[model samples]
Target: MTASKLYILDTNVLLHDPKCLYEFKEQDIAIPMTVLEELDDIKDRKKNVSSEARHAIRAIDHILSGASTSAQITKGVPIKQNALNGVDTRLGKLSIFPDHELTMRQGFLPNDHNKDNLIINCALHLQATNPHREIILVTKDINMRLKALGAGLLKVEDYRTDQLVSDIELLPAGHYQMEGNFWEHVTDVKSYQEGKYTFHQIDRSILPNTYPAEYIYDESDGFAARVISVDEETITLQDLNHERIMQQNCWGIEPINIQQAFAMQAVLDPSIDLAILNGAAGSGKTLVALACALEMVIEDKQFNKIIVTRSTPPVAEDIGFLPGTEEEKMTPWLSAIHDNLEAMHEQDERPQSSVKYAIEKANIQFKSLNFIRGRSIQDALVLIDEAQNLTPSQLKTIITRCGKGSKMICLGNLAQIDSNYLTPLTSGLTYIVERFKDYPGAANVHLEGIFRSELAEYAEEHL
Candidate 1:
């Protein structure tokens, strides 16, 4: 019988997903000592990944806690079965490899004090010694995968346990567009009125892919409706007037397109707890979100305050050294929010005064993502900008901080992801959009077209 494959992990893989320890089902996992050393060096750093490194270390320690001897640890430790997460049987063993003591071979890549070379050397040594087992090296770094393969490792793979979609193109667009009259497809429909709103109960077959809170629009017939509820047999859609939605104004800002109108409608609705907006860089995501937030806080009195935070790049660690209050320090990262605010009030006779009045009236607060971990925000409208830079775990940490009577709006542009560890397919924005599609209290809109400028639109398409 063929033996189970031995999979080796890299440092970035653990930092990418700390819970990855149990994700590999029934396969033996080997972590080189270099990875531990790297994690040790990083666990004490002030970066956002330090917490992830510590979590990875704790998971490793938990798995190897029962071993009494170095010999037993070197050989392998039986992974404890976790039935809660669906690990029903003890079929995998985890071991640590001492890569520093690996003997050099004639064709092996020179270590030269490089950490990646050390990891590659360990894989080469393991492959040379264990001829029967198929060894695979898993890392999130593309360069590390190339180096491992170049050093003669048989199989190298990426850590894809958190990936929800194989391709970004397969992701849902948050709204459906029908070419003709939407009623043409409905064979059975029962229209009714409930509290100044019209709802249609149609056979489920008419819109099999529709989900709650997703919009269905027909440009030809100028009809739009939102899927309010769905059952196995029928779907209930709340009818919306296209012209009325387009004419809706929030803080003097009206929707430029139907997609933006959909976003504004979702954000303004008090029943929706979460709204995700994704589009090109200049697609008015930030503008629309901020406009709705201001209206909710200052005009409608729905929310008491507006809390804005975003995932800053790890390299910008000088936020602590910057001389100012928390809001001032966050000003650099949250400049986009201010820019949108200024744009909203640009036509005012006293633009700067209007901006200041708006800020004070709304009780707007800028916060750092690192500082928002433990606090629960109540009666607030939270706007998270540049969300594509975050991992799924990081996004979850912020989302859970929303207490009762608080709403969250996440705005991201997948084309401009700045995180080295993320791609459009693995982005947290993409993850949430897919995970929360069917949720009744959440809505997602992928705003189309760049309304920022004609030049910006041309660059988005051509450049």
Candidate 2:
């Protein structure tokens, strides 16, 4: 028998990651009519709103067909997928919505500055009618959850279907240990540089992100040093021979971990124009790069714009066709882009309005690589988020978009690729690293830490 549960979803959550729907499958979902309205508002967005966005609309429409209707609009119908529709919930059962003649018009109405409030009210309406059912408000925005908790709503979780792993997969506090004499060197620096040396620790495999790894110098001089390896120890790092190191803390992120510090060394190095940062889900790769880029933008006055760009693959998304003005179609896909901006400003204590001001001034632009052919952004801080989903060819196009005096940061988790012709190992993140291994102007860093939350890190690993 199907149990009773009522769920209300926020629009930001859906637009950020469309897979939010399945997380509440078979539950009595009160689609905050306002969310539908918001979705309708952006139905013509071309860039980030993939055909999947339109497909999501059609998918919702299909679910709407079977739901039972009450006399008023406050009713929710049990949703089941149509076999022909291919939107199966897998645990589907029949449901109905209140068929009131008012069509929910008389119910709690939404207003300006009231989107989040209105969604919660819709969930409350469902809770009132369902009598003995669990009421949940599923949202990715932390503030929304806080407000919902203040309003007395319980039983909410993020949309986990698209999540790479679960809470149980997180490496616990004690998973990594560094013992004495972890590395036995087979060659000296001369031979090692010649690719004749291989280092190994008997009966022990080095873990990711753990450093200060002790390695014995097998040379006639006989000394000790730290070793960092990438991809089966084929490529190893003995040290960062930087001329100077900068002192700055990443905002809303921890002190630059060893991996990130190494990455920063390259980012700050005048030699490196292209660098790639890859890591697990909670890694500080993106945040660190973001902080450094913003640092240059604010303090150094180095660039005119921080042109942030990312790509999303379409799967029947068909955003209904993009006839509207640019900003109209661009708003839906740039939420995360804005989230990062907000966080940066939020931490810096600069007027929170700086982000919006920068965007309005064209100092911060969110672009899609879809048709970015001849446009060159010179002297800018360009950040290409989700570089993992981009093909090497596509990545090339984005990089070539950079102009003189511009620095581009590519951040993504190789474990999570969404583009075509790419896998974890073959993604652009890895491709960039392997190709630029010896380039003086290129560096690579892989972050491995949980800045989001303990639970989030756990889920990143376990789920």
Candidate 3:
């Protein structure tokens, strides 16, 4: 029989996903004393990290509480699969490794009191003592994993339990291109007309797993349509009336490309409550979102007001503390919002001061995401900028707060996530784009063309 491997987890692995303890089935799991210390320090932090830390500590405490004695915990306790609501079922032993003489014998530098190095020392001690079993250090920090391998630990890996995709390129762009001869494949179809749109029903077998609001285009024929309904037998598509809408100005701004036009249509539709726009740095994700929101709140009178929020992340180093109200502190992070509003005002041929006047009269609100809990926003256009920095849990909280008659628009560039724990594949923006793709009231667009400026586009491409 093959011996089970011993996996030593870092504090980041726990904070990234609190349920990671049960992911390693039938393998011995070790938690270093240094990791517990780190969790204790982080348990009181704000937002997702604190919630994850507290949940992880509680899970560990729950397991230890059922143990017969403290010595039983030291000797290793069996992690039953039935504990976590019966989702995981692997009989593995869990033990907390104390900082002992074995760790000191590893000969790490006495002055290197960093938590990462101390965790590596614990894994090294386990490898030295247990010759028959393999020991691996599982960490989410890339630099820590590299440091462990450089320190002569042969087994090291990243925690990938929460990653939805192995590569960012594999994520769906929410659209598909049909061949020039696409109409030749359709047979036994039903047709009808509603307003300016011509609806067609084709067999669902032709496009398996096709989702509502997904765009399909044929370049050669200059034909485009969006899936409106999906049934077990057939899918209904509505011909895109791009000519009229594409030429119409949205709040004095025009879409520069076909993708942007599609985004405008999705945002203007009152039936669709959720819209996501993702793109490169200069792809106008924020501009289109802000324009549509202003039009909805001011020109159309469809929504009561506009609420804007975004993640606050420093560029290089922490700026310590700012003295002011919540909105004053958020001004530094929301410069893009201010810039886009000013540009819209200029396009409307209004005086510069009118931007502030319009915002105040229209009841536009700038909110910090930190205080969004327990409040239901009704009949509002809620715009979440820089959404890539949010975790799935944070995104869920924001989405669930949308009350009746409210719509949400998420704008972000996946390449520019600033959160230390989030990545393109595991970000909250990506999560919603994938999960809500098939929902009838949700639509997504990936804008490609850069409309900010020639210099900005050049920098985005080359640098």
Report the Cα lDDT for residue 174, model 2: 12
TM-scores, each model vs. reference:
0.95, 0.47, 0.90
lDDT of 2 at 286: 61
lDDT of 1 at 7: 90
> Which candidate number has the best TM-score?
1
Worst lDDT window (10 residues) for model 1?
Answer: 314-323
Residue 98, candidate 2: Cα error in Å is 54
Q: Give the TM-score of candidate 1.
A: 0.95
**Which model scores highest in lDDT?**
1
lDDT tens per residue, model 1, 153-198: 9999998888888989888888899878887778888999999889
Clashes of each: 0, 34, 0
* Candidate with more favorable, higher TM-score: 2 or 3: 3
1-463 in candidate 3: lDDT tens per residue?
3337989999988877788888987888889888899999988755447777888899888767768876778767778778878755646788888854343554453425788888888887778778889999999788989988887787999888767777878666766777765586687889899886699899998778688998776656466678899999999988775565567477788988778877888888887899998999889888888888878888889999988888777778878777799888777888898888887787555657878876876687888887886789899999899999887777887999999999999998898988777778888888898889779899898999787899989988887
TM-score of 2: 0.47
lDDT of each: 0.88, 0.56, 0.82
Over 1-463, each residue of candidate 2 has an lDDT whose tens digit, in order, gives: 5457666666655654454455555665666557777677767765444433554567566656654553323444445443345664454332323212113444444434476777766665666666787877777666777776766566655544433323323312111323433234323332244244233332123344433222222233222223434344333544332212224454334344445555665465454687677777766666677666666666556677777777756545555655566555655655666676676677555756777664655466766675565788788877788888765556766788878888878888766766533455445555565555545465556566777779988898888
lDDT score, residue 325, model 3? 90
Q: What lDDT score is found at residue 453 in candidate 2?
A: 75
